[model samples]
Target: MNIDPHKLTPRARNALSRAGLLGQSTRVYELVQSGEICYLSNIGTKTYRELCRYFGVRCDGKYPARRFKPVNAVYLKQCIHYLRGHGYTVIEPSQSHNQ
Candidate 1:
């Protein structure tokens, strides 16, 4: 479980850095349709794992899905904050929903 920080991608490194910042950080986790269902893009394994751990959600393969959104809704925006903070482009639904 000891991942070399330098070995990770910049996005993953950034995600680890923001692990503590997500608590109580609401920033609107948006939705993007991909493959069959909506999923979070630009999020590496480390980022996804960190988010799930912080949100108290199990890694059931649904963190980025529309169903498992916003860490249980109620406007607890955290994913978007991380995504935006990293300056990753948001997958626009209008542009390509089923791509």
Candidate 2:
């Protein structure tokens, strides 16, 4: 079943866009093929799990109700490098995580 990006929440679509995974390059394939959604800049695990559920993607994890925080800046930097190698034009965030 092909999941349409338009069917997902605006936040989810934007999340995929930020990760360079929207459009023809949506990693929905990767999600289904690899069973993993690589961490993106602004997307958190909760949003991710929600997106997964909407798309019927099977990922291994537990999602208990709790406070949701933003993605860690350090982790996003790590993902930036990995995504760049995949032909993604990822911009390094200007705001320092230190502050």
Candidate 3:
């Protein structure tokens, strides 16, 4: 089954909705299959990360790497590993169809 962006945290969902990416033109599954999502005015790095986590995809190259504290790195790595193990497709921002 495809991941659901709506499953993201409330703050992230609000950001996405305001950005006109979520619940607007493209469905989350279509966005995933296309391998990218357009960047909007309010879709910042934090929001992007939340989207990545929600859709079970990793960020490719367009967005800068998020800097986590040393202690958090382990946790983040674990999360990534978990996502990958579950078979999520990671994509880049440049690949967004709307772009």
TM-score of 3: 0.41
lDDT of 1 by residue, 1-99 (tens): 344456645664565444432222333122111211123354544566554444344555644454444443324245545555665444433324333
* Tens digit of per-residue lDDT, candidate 3, span 1-99: 533455678777776565445554346544443333332334556665666667667766455333221135456456546544544332322324323
lDDT of 3 at 49: 63
Q: Estimate each model's TM-score.
A: 0.31, 0.51, 0.41
lDDT of 2 by residue, 42-98 (tens): 655666676767766664656321122226767656666776677655446557643
Runs in model 2 with CA error above 4 Å? Answer: 1-3, 32-36, 63-80, 88-99
Candidate 1: deviation at residue 77, Å? 22
The prediction achieving the highest lDDT against the true structure is 2
For candidate 3, give the lDDT of residue 32.
40
Per-residue error (Å), model 2, residue 51 = 2.2
- Output the better candidate (1/2) by lDDT: 2
